[model samples]
Target: MLKFTTNLILLFISVTAFAQDSLSVETAAIDTVQVQQASKDSTVYKQRYGLRVGIDLSKPLRSFLEEDYQGLELLADFRISHNVYIAGALGNEEKTTQEDNYNFTTSGSYLKVGLDWNTYENWYGMENIINLGFRVGASTFSQTLNAYQIYNTNQYWNEIQSGIMGEDMLGEYSGLNALWAEIVLGMKVELFRNVFMGASVRLNYLVNNTQAGNFPNLFIPGFNKVTDGSKFGVGYNYSISYLIPIFKGNKPQKLPSNNQQEQED
Candidate 1:
């Protein structure tokens, strides 16, 4: 933290000392002018363009067999208004497994439209940003056990099959696929005027679950109602961003426009 403060102080001193180089003014009057008008807005950070790259700290929306506990992402945002922005993102994930019952791995990618609301302003205090987002994408997963997984549970079918006896008592079925929808919430903190860090949590609900062959009126993972079990789960992401201003810096040096300005210049 000390290093951080030291760097900030140095940056201020450098900007203050050099902002005058743009001027042909005398050295003695330079310090005086700064004291009178360094910058009108000194406590806020706003930007026209933002870029963020970070990692997910919780599970991803991929299939359980290849789901990642952590992953990385790269994103870009364009501020459309104060506290509002449009964003585009892309990411990747990987895994290695020992058992061959499932696909070696599954990866996921998504696009989201989100809203950001500034809840607080003090960068070092409780400064917070609330982010709400929605995403659409696909994931990968597969089951390689048997035609009929020895331990399959079907609430609807189980009741109907109970009456089956003899040869009809035993049968087999295929597996399922992975594709889903995502919803997210996040908060950000300013660690530097142009830099910030934050945490995010998201929920994913599967969108497809094909049943055994072409069964009539059957349910699946992303398909019809197979079970009442919660079809959703939780995950988290950690991110950092940089915000660079549009057209302003320390205000430009000026030439006297009138006698009053002549004395100040």
Candidate 2:
């Protein structure tokens, strides 16, 4: 009877120890799961920020195509307030035309300021984006109309080609300026974790018309001196850009205080 009682006591102790070990293992797994979830949340928040700096490519409208004109913009984006970025940009567009009658190139650079309103939040892979914006800026515009007629290799600008042949150009001039309004649509996609590719389109119209007769009778922004048998017009821009993230730092957030309280409960 004494031996049998001893065996029963040992079996009871074994069962209790096993139950305790199982409970400890379950608790450890629960703690591990919570840590992993918190880690994920921190990772997501790291991607959130209020500023982005980048560049832009602009292709002017039809009137700008015939000339060797393409524009590039340098930008600074600031988030003085949530979901809104106030920005400043400097840009340049170069136009070149060569023909039997005329050979010339005109390059333009301008300073710009604008506001961006971002309403898109859920679009994945679209951290670099073009919020709706309005831009008003001034550019010191200049052009050289060197030839009586420029050859149209692509047949893209027949009107300008014919004007050059007519020798309607009087001379080239500097000291022209114009104010412009831009409607821009732009976005960026990630090529790597910190590198992104971007593109934008803009509609640019000159607010002032100052014409130069001495230069070829080609249309140039802000240089519309007169409408004497020459046509002055607006332009469009198609641009591509790259965004590189600099100065990335790791910041870890502590778990919410309520979580510990709930786990204790």
Candidate 3:
């Protein structure tokens, strides 16, 4: 009976040691996994932040194809934060319009300043943007009274003139200016490396204009045509820009698993 008890006690000790060894191994394995996860969580990715400069692709291309329109526009933006950018455009336009009783030309340069908000949630390693923007714009431009035939309601006199009114008609209407505001919707896609392609549509409201005497302001350079009773205009641009990365930013990392964190603590 004593011998039997001794053997049983020895077996119990051996089993307990084995169980303790197994537990230790499991604990060590868990600690190793936690360490690996923590290391992965500490990894950082640098985001690109900089100034982007480009030209309006549509304007130049249109100028090449349209005889009545010639335009050039430069676009630029500086990324100030993760989802915010300061943007603007500088442009010159000369457009000729022929109407039933008039043909006129408007030429001018304009500048706009605005801010853009990026609304897209990009995937990992992707930096495309869907944006909503606002701008306040001003233009200094002039209109030329090219040629006009006086529209007389009474046709009693068959005299219709279709040439410039006088020597003073073909020159610029100096000091004519305008101010406006716009809401823009756009998207930018990274095409290759730091190059991007973007398009935006603008809804504009004319705030004010300085017109020339006798002849109404038919067209304002950046604001487009002035309608009979409407103060609104619509415009759009397609662009290709190159980003010059000025700095790198790091996005906030996600938190580690609570259970793992607690175990570590």
lDDT (Cα, 0-100) at 237 in candidate 1: 62
lDDT by residue (11-98, candidate 1, tens digit) is: 9999988877756466657887776554532333432334444443333434343533234456555555545656544554433332
Task: State candidate 1's TM-score.
Answer: 0.44
All candidates in order of lDDT, best leading: 3, 2, 1
Candidate 1 global CA lDDT score = 0.47
How close is each model in CA RMSD to the real structure? 19.5, 13.0, 7.9
Clashes of each: 5, 24, 0
After superposing candidate 3, which stretches have Cα over 4 Å from the reference? 1-42, 156-171, 253-265
Q: What is the TM-score of each candidate against the true structure?
A: 0.44, 0.51, 0.78
Off by over 4 Å in 1: 1-70, 96-104, 108-113, 119-128, 138-179, 209-228, 244-265
lDDT of each: 0.47, 0.58, 0.88
Off by more than 4 A, model 2: 1-51, 57-72, 98-104, 123-130, 149-170, 213-265
Q: After best superposition, candidate 1 residue 112: deviation in angstroms?
A: 4.0
Better of 1 and 3 by TM-score: 3
Query: On residues 33-115, what C-alpha lDDT tens digit does candidate 2 reach at each position?
Result: 99987775454333344455665534345335554556566666665443576766776766666655657666667787888
What is the per-residue lDDT of model 3 for residues 6-31, given as tens digits with 9 covering 90 to 100? Answer: 99999999999999999999999999
